[model samples]
Target: MKKNTLTFIFAVGALIFFSQLSAQENPLSVGFKAGTGLSNYRLSGDMKSFTSKMSIGGSVGGFVKYDLSSNFALQSGIDLYYSTSKLDSKVDKSSNKLKSLGVEIPLYGIVQGKLGSGKAFIGAGPYVGYGISMKSNGVNLFKNSNEAGKLVMNRFDYGLGGIAGYDFDKNWQINASYQLGIADLLKGKGGSMKNHGISVGIAYKF
Candidate 1:
């Protein structure tokens, strides 16, 4: 219920932002992007049973940007991404693993500064994610499900993200970004799941 409410709020906010952008004189630009992402899970509190590891994946997304001024813009996008990680066991002989597919919606406010003919930009934003599907491979170290009789994997996550990039021209840009999950993604009571990743991608503006 909380997850659904948060998702609704973000969707409404994005809609309002885009609606306002439509009234501006120079409102819209569309683009295609592709990038590689690294994913990891972090454990917090008293998580003695969990271990952290890294996974490499990729993402592709389409974005619409609204130029608020010569120095600022509002950008929003939807992306499809995959992440994988392994959980090691210190006491047990078997390890648990996970693979997840997610759909992410990001809304960003970016500040652009000039560096000669090329432009440099920094952006920070909030992102909401829905885990479309997940697979548990490897061995099952935990034998019991949650209170709802569901596996301890959560289907929703929210996070903060930032990006630094340079535009060579109106149509070409490159960016490096990091996203940190601010919420606990695991459904069970014991461990926390967070993702931190670096991505490099090229964008083509139209």
Candidate 2:
């Protein structure tokens, strides 16, 4: 319920932003992109006191973009991403790390402006991801109280994202973006954990 509400709000907000910024329609373009991402988990609710270190990962994907006007466009893409995080506690003498891989889909509403002879774009939207693999290394503080579980994370992840980029030419683009997770990653959790991160990459349109 909370996850659905947040996703819906983000989608609607992107639509409203796009509608107001669109000016002239342009043709569609397809592109490929690859980049590195840095991520970490934010534990909230009952787990607010927990601490985690940032994770480093990479993403490779393809995207399609349709220009709503000369200055606005909509973009969607699919990417395979790898994420990891290290967890620790101050009061409790325990430590753990999580590693996961997933597929992500992002729907971004973009606004473009002239930058000298090139173009600059900024986009924001919502993204949803499904974990292909996830595991944790630490004591299974729940079941055995000494053994780690095989898989400890939920499959679905949803959040809000924002991206900004510049086109150096008709074919090359450089961009950076961030994802703020709203859904809890742990399934049947004693607490809540969410993934959030930033990515910087390059893209080529062909």
Candidate 3:
């Protein structure tokens, strides 16, 4: 009877050691994700009176994440975003429309917690963007001008963002996030641009 008990203990120790080794062998995970993003720009201070409306547009991007532990990781990616807004002037009788194209890069560190069958994660990071092009369309509201030139927006912008996501398994996830701009995208000091959106996509771990 004593010999049988000693053998059982030895078997349990071996099982635990092998399980730990298997986990270490698969520590790194990589995946691809793409989804639609809704973007809008907000004006600040006195500029709010002139541009009361915010623009809404779509964005898509791909990302790569490296797992640092079971509950933490670091991720980085690139995205293309489009946005448009309408400006109505109370003083003038007409309105103007603006469209902008932007490229953004984000670096984030994430912390995760497991809940039943799904895992939830939260992340915060900084992002930088460059405006590639901008155009204005509409009737000229300025009193002296018959036509308006193409809109020139600030090329460089920076912001902070927060993200929350849930993973159903190792290969699938959905997320929602908010981003606030700290730098002005418009050439002058008129206003700063802000964006918020939700996205759902599939991720494959390798």
Candidate 4:
């Protein structure tokens, strides 16, 4: 119920967000993008005492953008990303390095302006994600715990994202982005774990 509520709020919030920011409509464009992402796990709620280190991974995606005008646009896309980060506990003598692959659906409102002849853009939005794979030390993290018989991690991840970049040409773009995850990763609830990610990538419009 909590996860559903959060996703609903974000969906509604995104609609309201762009409706206000975009005044005029322009043409639509489609693009392909690839990049590297650095991610780390954040402990929260009952799991606040834990720690994790950042990991580098790959991201590939395609997007369609609706030009609200030369000054603003709305973008949506499907991104596939991977991450491997170490999670540890101070009180418990345990350390785990998790690797996961996930897909994200993002909706963003982009603000565009001129920078030295090229166009610069900054945007903020929300994303919905689903994990296709998650493992720690050769063990599946999404499976049931051997001793507890409860699921170890949740596959559903939803969050807010921000991005900024420059368009060197009508068909080319370079960008940096960050995603702050809001959903708890723990499935059956002994605690909470969330994800934070930073990515840099390039895009080619079609």
Candidate 2: tens digits of C-alpha lDDT, residues 1-206: 99999999999999876775453433588999999988898887656666878978899999999887677789998999987777777667577787777899999999998998789999999999988777665323223232343325568889999999999978999999999999987665567888889989999997
List TM-scores for all candidates, in order: 0.78, 0.79, 0.71, 0.83
lDDT of 3 at 72: 73
Residue 57 displacement in candidate 3 (angstroms): 2.2
- Candidate 3 stretches with Cα past 4 Å from truth are 1-25, 138-151, 189-206
Give each model's whole-structure lDDT. Answer: 0.79, 0.82, 0.67, 0.86
Model 2 ranges off by over 4 Å: 1-26, 138-151
- The residue pairs in collision within model 1 are none
Off by over 4 Å in 1: 1-26, 138-151
Question: Which candidate leads the pack in lDDT?
Answer: 4
Count of clashing pairs, candidate 4: 0
How many collisions per candidate?
0, 2, 0, 0
Worst 10 residues of 2 by lDDT: 138-147
* lDDT for 147 (candidate 1): 40
Question: Comparing 3 and 4 by lDDT, which wins?
Answer: 4
Q: What value does the lDDT take at residue 119 in candidate 2?
A: 96
- Worst lDDT run of 10 residues, candidate 1, spans 138-147
lDDT (10s digit) by residue, model 1, range 61-166: 9999888766789899999998777767666656656777889998999998789899899999999998877767532323344345234666778899998899
At residue 167, give the lDDT of candidate 1.
89
